[model samples]
Target: MKTSDTTDDLRQKLTHELARKRALLIDRHPNARNSLRIMLTALGVTDVHHAGRSVEVLRQVKAHHFDMILADYQLEDGRDSQQLLEELRQNHLVALSTVFIIITSERAYHNVVSIAELAPDDYLIKPFTADELHGRLIRALYKKHFFAQLYEQLDNGAFTEALSTCERLLGQESAFLFDALRLKGGILNALGRYAEATRVYQKVLEQRVVPWARMGLAMALRGQHQLAEAEDVGQSIVTEFPEFTAAYDFLAEVQQDLGKPVEAQEVLQRAAAISPNNSTRQRLVGDVAARNNDLATAEKAYGNVLRRRRGSSLKNLDDYSNLTRVMLDRGHAESARQVTDELRREWRGNRQGELAALIMDSLCAAKEGDAVKARHAVEKAILLHEALKAEGATTRVSQKMTVDLAQACLATGNEATAQEIVRQVAAENHEDRAMIAQVQRIYSKAGKAEKGQELLAQVGREIVELNNRGVLAARSGDLQGSVQLLVEAAERVPNLQFLVNATKAIFTLLELKGWDATLAKRGLRYLALAQTKDMRNPKVISARETYQRVARKYGVPIVPLGPSRSPESGPG
Candidate 1:
């Protein structure tokens, strides 16, 4: 039969079915039943063009600004039921409130099982009764309304309020208890309330070992700097739910933070193997490989991203940046230049991207022996960073960038300017070990190894002296005096690893030897500061464990603070 004739007959059938079910029909197809047309004469819905194929009609209705959409999974264009549902979701034409129904034959059940991505609000198998459709539709719409407020708060990033709404719904209706638990856990995790989040996750684990709940709990533990515990939980999760991609992602992050780059790369590789279609996972694997200087692996990963290019958007500038750097390392300077040029053109207006592009440009110019152009680009890069700082951009153009500019200046024989820039940054960040290391490396590259070593030793001695005074004050039995001395010491050397580490040791000793509640808390504050200074340090790890043990010994219920803030943020 012709599509038009078939649609006409189906429209009549739908009219009879709606009357049989006592429900209204808002068909998007142009075909209308003579009986339905007469029936609509009494009702409303005068729009006709808004009413042909279900998928296109829904898209048109959205552009035309309709209140709701009633779409069947099957359409007249020989598209299967699942494709229609996927299209709606991908296009976001189906809002959280939008009601969708799948019209399928019994044979489509096997097809439905094969399709992992399509999800409809209601599914109607052929030979289903009209009463079943009405009952299902009413339930879906009512549930949508019930969760409307919760959805609204989440969309607006008011995660705490979303948790409150979930609590209210879960109390009044047992049916939504699991959903409430999930939402509450998610919000608590986002807010860095990991200890409380762990409790919520424990409740979820009681019912079932959900991968998401397991991953959430693991993340909370990781936030607490409890890497061993997080790794244990992640291992269990991946073993049981090997297909869960997020579990591997979290595992990779925790492993990388714990200084296990090879393990992290293996985890990411396993995840990519299981779900080979994920471009982001491919990119991450590439990054880990590139960091290890595994150019071959990095190239393969970048090739995957290039093959699936989403077209000239700044979709993943880091991947392109890393790719170019890898190419440069491999001595494929032309390929490196080509990638940088593409990114430069694509991200011309983005200040951060422009800076990155400028850095790459300077590097390229230096390689080509164009000292004049390299000097200009490096100067431009520094000015761009100054502009960003003035505009209060949250992104930091790290002190490393300053070091780079200095190196470029030095290379071009602008020794006075290079020396001045390096001196300014070194003086300003006198206590930052990583920045110190970077400065030393830059000077060494410029064949000034003795000067770099002298600078590093000078900074180290200043930090050691500050810490010694604080320790002497603490050892004098002046607990308050000790804390005051240490606090002042920390302020003076906030970014110094040795100074921060000493502060942490003092706090640990105080927690063990004294019984002051405020002092114990203060100890935690310092331990967090130490961890921030060197997150993966074995000494920081031991100090944190000692602090936690002391807190538990006193029954103080010390909440593990989430991801340590930068030491410069100070004491909070």
Candidate 2:
């Protein structure tokens, strides 16, 4: 019995030695071979298989799975070793963050460590001993465990909780300070606390300029309607970090908002060059090109976006809707219909899809001179609006839909209904200048140009009468009456130059009578609003100048203002 046991032990020892020799042959690196061999010898690890090449070895590693991966700093084709590890984790091709240790030479340290998120759990220097590698792996596991809660919160989109944890962690001044701050900024942005988010970003930047910090600041500025400032910041980021994609997005948005369509397209082109797979970027380029009347480029960009990817975040139905419109505009009705059919198949009766199809129906019917079909579609839209209204859905923006329906109604010779619809939209959105302009366009498009002009002229005359009343009231020293009339007139005829002038006059007279900081500030607010709508309108400029004078006279610091050109001469 003793002799038989001895024979079995000898056979096992031989098998183990052969396996070790095979493992050594598979590992090309001297350190990997030596360190792994040492571990195998210590553990007497049996059943080891040898891989013929790097691909084979990686496949075996994937199949067998290691508790920790000691990857070379420079992998096949100059790919970052850490990134390969992350790709494995991300794709579930490997277990999560399985103690990835980047094995690097001293010369490659900087190159290996330059990337974020893909930073290894540890770095195993050349000539590392088995003991050193093992120690680093254990340390990484402990550190990861310590922050597991934070990792989970961040990954699960519990940004508010994550931000709170980050704040607490920041008090400890941990090595993850910047990461915490960055995560906080992202959370604040997600929550729409753009101003606070911007402050946090700037705070980090003031310490040391970082690409993300700069990008975050630009985003905040964009949120605040400070597009010009955002554009400048975006340009600076691009100049410094030409490869950064987010900077290009910021630049495109700023330029678009500032009415520079061509510049927006240029930024989008640069972005596409960097990341062509992004359907959103391609669609944006196409939209901007379309806006600039560059049909050929627009068509190419849209076609690329539609053709390239099947299932992506960039494959929004809105993109297809917009593309279809462009196609129709380019006299490709059949092509537009093809896209519409594809969308119908994809969406499979979604409400938004139905709405888009209806809008397209209206457009097609209008083009084909089928006024009856157009009116039917418009009525369907109105019915949808009625349903939404019954539901008390506050989020429903029905004005645009109403305007569209009104236009269709007018086109079909339902003048009475069209007039009533326009009146309803005007009354509901009397405060919004952009909405008013859209209303005017809808009227003009439906062959009601004279009617639209008459409506605005009547509104203008009403505003003028109110302005005169306010002016007379102020001159007669009835300050309260003057303020009341002017405020009412301003509301009634917003963006009308003379009414704004009347409001300014009354506010200044009130301030002159007594110290009403609130009144003065209210006057400045009206003045600012007026300036934004038409900076070159005489009333806006005069009010702004008056506010500046009042601010100085009362020792109130003049608030920083926007462009306010002197208004052109108009009737007194």
Candidate 3:
């Protein structure tokens, strides 16, 4: 086992270089951090930080630029390092230059989500020595450096430069040629150049079958609305690599789009079986399950969401709210009341939470045949709604909470309140034919279909007038006036197509006239409200793009429309 002096010298040099590398070690266990510290120290790494929680880890990454992040897959939080990486990437919190190497104890982690698809730098199993770990890190660093220009452009959201860089580097003989091609495919897909992306992915596939490349091909096809072909590709990927969670998720989305929600549910259920603890996955499972009228499955999925929320600060309150909603639907009054009680306890001082719990109580009371209590609950809810409005809560968010309030109002014989609530919903969603229909059905179920139609007509007329005036304002070179009129009109009826179009027109006017910071902000605010109504609305999507373009042109942060919520006004 004799080694040459030259080999020893090279090892010493590599070790010295690694010592200067800034590293961050993240694990929930103190012992794990200590162990990793020792291992990394052996590699001559002197600068390192340890974080036992994601919040702290994120704080670290956000505060300092780390060269390497060695994260344990299983963090104390409900999410793993993969989820952490996702948050970091999606929010642009970290540069792609930072090498992320995830460490997991179980091989099963590999089957849950595709590391290649998500593009984490590397994956390692437990019981690895410093040298093996170092070897992996070296390759990852090499890859990161080799694709520096592409990553630089990508991190800056410079798709054109990224594509050009990938193209230039792709035809040359390089160790990272396949990686370059993958990056090119990703850039093309991001730009919605689907046919070119398909060719790039196919080229990678011809070189060798890769999970990420196959998934990219499926995604490009889906982008082109080639649902059947995308499904085939997605199904094959999942069949061949059952661990590819993205494929399953994509396939399920395609199925839902194709009106095969039941199939989507099955696909997600399988993914859940493999990665049971992912809250987002569980939430999606609940949504599809509920959509398909599989209440039992839906309840179980939301219950899973609730359980996962217990220890995690990143709680989605909708899980508790939806749990109560469906429990009432299933005629489980006691269960619904208990869930509402838990929600109240969990969010004791929250105004919105208090209102939601009150709404749920009314539902439970009605289900339990307590008319007086239900009516009183509705009255209390009305007061809470007024109180929130007094505290500056926008009334334009026509979501499930408001729908539940309307439903509670009707259940409690508060017909006037019910009419006003449904009317507001109709006003906001004047252009959403489906939602308008749902609102009509809401009244029909309560024996007020004709009245509902009249209210919708009244509100629709008001929205149309406002929209028409706003269009005239924009056309007259009154960009600010147009923005004000359109945003106010949109807010009056949060999800109206007319108002959405008006916002888009205002955005265009602003674009032509150059950015007015306040007006552009207002435009985003209006689009965000519209998104809460129907994110898939074409008008909303177009306005969102326009808003981003203005934001980018103005050198401001492109405000992302807040989270897209589950439809609150959908047919029960």
RMSD of 2: 18.1
Alpha-carbon lDDT, every model: 0.61, 0.61, 0.74
Q: Tell me how candidate 1 scores on lDDT.
A: 0.61
Clashing residue pairs found in predicted model 2: none
The per-prediction tally of clashing pairs is 4, 0, 6
Could you tell me which 10 consecutive residues in candidate 1 have the lowest summed lDDT?
A: 563-572
Write the residue-wise lDDT of candidate 3 on 1-572 in tens digits: 12233534644454556877899999988998999999888877879898998778878977888889998887874677877776666555677778898888767465534533355777888888888988887777766656677776666445556678788887766677777777777667666688998998898888799777888898789889999999999899899988767678888988977878799999999988877767778888987787667889989999989988774556655778778877876778899888998989987897788888888888888889999988898899899898777877845322557777888887778889888887776776565544565566557657788887888888878877877888898789787687677667666655556556656866787778887776666666666666665553435555665666666776878654542211111000
Model 1 lDDT at residue 29: 43
> What is candidate 1's lDDT per residue for 345-375, written digit by digit as tens?
7767877778878877776777677888888
By lDDT rank, best first, the candidates go 3, 2, 1
Q: Which stretches of candidate 3 lie over 4 Å from their true place?
A: 1-22, 42-47, 53-65, 77-79, 87-93, 105-117, 148-165, 168-173, 393-398, 419-572
Deviation of model 2 at 380, angstroms: 5.2
TM-score-sorted candidate list, best first: 3, 1, 2
- lDDT for 162 (candidate 1): 65
- TM-score winner, 1 or 2: 1
